[model samples]
Target chain A: MIPDDRKYTQEHEWVQVEGDAGVVGVTDHAASELGDIVYVDLPDVGAEFSAGDSVGSIESVKAVADLYIPVSGEIIEINEALDGDPALVNNSPMDDGWMFKVRLADPGELETLLDAAGYEDLLGK
Target chain B: MSDLKQTPLHQWHIDHGARMVEFAGFAMPVQYEGVLAEHATVRDAVGLFDITHMGEVFVEGPGAGAWLSGLITNSIIKGEPGKVTYTAMCNEQGGTLDDMLIYRLTEERWLVVMNASNHDKIVDWMQRHLPAEGVTMDDASDRTGLIAVQGPDSQDLVGRLEALAPHVAPIAELGFYTHIAVDGPGGEWIVSRTGYTGEHGYEIYLPAGAMLAAWEELLARGEDLGVRPIGLAARDTLRFEACYCLYGHELSEDWTPLEAGIGWAVKLKKKAGFIGRDALAAQKEAGIPRTLIGLEVEGGPIAREGCPVLAGDREVGHVTSGTFAPTLQKKLALALVEKDFAEADLMVEVRGKRLATRHRALPFLAARVKGDPRAERALS
Candidate 1:
């Protein structure tokens, strides 16, 4: 359920470029693969991190997945809605599941991620 | 995975859009309409399960009843012909070798159905222990297929099957933990009022090769009655809610029935010199180091197996089986904990975070079966 406008990470996180920084969330592929999302521990606001670093955790009915930071930056805001109904991540992975806002720590790292076409090839979609 | 086994109804399951997964070395179906939904169907309406993965063994001879009585923890000879019994065969250490159903087809014949993973183990154990020359323990699992139709409407759905109509008239009349040979689409079969879902259901055993034909006939006819093909995922959750023990989780070589809260299965009054008799009796008197307990988490994220169970500030146990009870809408966890922490309202640590967990009485979601005389039967 990933949109063509979004950038992709091999780790299954998706990023949609919103003006300057990016809106980040786990891919629908990830959520469906995890089955049911029961809990999502979000990263704290103003939390700075580097690319490929661990950001948070996404738990499902049977398993738990480590959410990775695709772009090195600070988490500007967390998805507070997920605290109440984590299922939102499963219902709207690209939209409501948008986990946090990252104030781009290194915009240059964005180039290292796959574009919509490249990512599609990786998934063989 | 080359040698992985498949149930007789494997192709039928695939045709119905089942997602298959490898479980206990068998390529088994794990879901059809999603675990939660299928689980609910079984709890509310009726759900059909391809339980061919369960191993079926038949033992016969004049010495059958007496020989089996010495092997299992429950009374095998007490059940009349065409009746069933739930019992556990334990190791010398009082650990469960297999929890199985003993079906008495006749005075001299019996059928033992066990977990697919423990089929070889149980057979080997029988071969090693029950060494009577006249008795025969035949592995009928490969030649037999089991189908469980469970829930409230199961009786109505299964009773109408043309092949079963003659012998299974008024299916609800058959007491729980009882069975009789009946005609099926493919051949004559055995139908028992046995289910793991804690519901009023029936378990039908038929010739293995004809399971596809039988499953198709049942599915096609039961569709209008809300019968759906369920899978292992739903099976696990349903049983967990009912507090049924999975072999690997609630039982293992290192765990004993006394410690697992199933000490009631151990027979201390018998002089049959059964395996694990002494060890279980001693444990029953002196008590065990650890005990199995049930926990209900207040919030989200079902506590799963291997998650550390923290009692206050200490890691006192590990969860054995945990899942979201779709019927109760609660996260449940069954833990094997130190006897010291087996009290009510024991807290649990899920993924490094502590949650207020209630250690309530198990069978987290109890089902109410309509009045059946089988209620008086000690099938527990």
Candidate 2:
């Protein structure tokens, strides 16, 4: 199910804004399609990225996909638990699987993100 | 997509929520539940595979052994009945046409199991040279269903098949590379103590009509042993860890068996005058220019197939089969490299960046082949 609260990207990442910081993670569909999450690669905290930049990557047994930053921001904190238990991304992509927290560089970039209905329409679901 | 083939267990896979993908013209399961979980299940316990997508061809005649000996690199004439020999069929230029397992069913009969993608190629290659008065080849792929039950506890699961209980002795005592014909729900099938994964396992080739029953029975009986259906994704990783060559990836028409690390299987001294004997023997005398070596990357970015292998500033080779091995927990790859550059301590270009790598030995993990003299006593 596409959650209504967060903004979604065509790349399948979900972003939720809390004050000036945004929490980011992949969508449920992305996690399901990748099959067992074997490894997750994230950039170091304090790293700045432009909107749609390849911030990191996630690898499963059969495939690998580059993780895109949904909006331009500077990474503040990353979920360190994922280093040992990458399966958390598959188990709870929307919540505990959140990859990192970033302080927004420009709140205007969120306007380009898709709403829940738009994301569902993009999936044709 | 319309011409894509479906195996007998196609619907069964879909019903189990398998994510399907087009592989060699068949809609096969890439993963089910998850690839990591399925891989771990096979490594630690037992797992089943629907390998009906593989091709099975039979040759039978008075001259079957002698005729096959001429077409393959292995000495098939010396292999007795019920024994299996892994060999590579090569072109006159010594490039591999396909690597297959040949089972001598009897003095006049033989079964050749080949990769699905090379089924037509192998058939045409054999037919062109088949002795007119002797050997006859028949394609049994459509009627055959191959199921691999692999892991340490696979033997116990096979013993519980009620319909197959009477034939338990062969299953219990079957040596590696040996097979036995058993009467079962499928009328009759060959149970071979052979597997692609490095684990101790059995591959059952039976009638497609009776595949479902066998699959269900294996799952039902293997429940306590944690037997689950494994997908192709894990199958590749498992075989990769074992350093098994995948046709299009590692073994190919452009590479010879000598360079692919199967030189031991090439019997050039045999007097049968095999297909590529002259070329392989000539290469042997001159020494193979390239050799296949295993590589382990430091971390994250995987070195996939076709990735260039670097020796300082010069690109010396390319990766063939690579993966993040589930059991070993390392990003490993098999690369065909210049003989001089195959030594330990190398690097690979992954995603435009060079990653530090080390040349590990083949079969990253110790193989648990049943009859290997050096194999540890434990089944795993």
Candidate that scores best on DockQ: 2
What are the root-mean-square deviations of the candidates from the true structure over C-alphas?
Answer: 3.1, 2.4
Rate residue B244 of model 1 by lDDT: 84
Q: Distance (Å) between predicted and true CA of B108, model 2?
A: 0.3
lDDT of each: 0.81, 0.88
**Tens-digit lDDT track of model 2 for B1-380:** 55889988888999999888888888888888777788889888899999998999999999889889889998878778989999999999899999999999989999999999999899999989988887889999999999999888888888888866888887888899989886777677999999988888899999999998889989999899999999999999989888888999989888799999998889998886888889998988998999999888876578889999998888899999888888888888899999988884678997788899876877787777755423453211
Q: iRMS of every model, one decimal? A: 2.3, 1.5
Please name the candidate that would achieve the greatest lDDT relative to the true structure. 2
lDDT tens per residue, model 1, B1-380: 45889887777677878878888678888888677778888877788888888888889999998999888887767678978888888988888888889999999999989998898888888888776487988888877888898887788888777678776564657776788886665665999888888788889898987677767777788888788888888888888877888888988878787777777766778767678888888887886889888888876566888888876678888899987777776778899999977884466677676788876677675644545412432211
Which residue pairs collide in model 1, if any? none
The DockQ figures for the candidates are 0.47, 0.65
Segments of candidate 1 deviating more than 4 angstroms:
B185-187, B370-380
Identify the candidate with maximal TM-score: 2
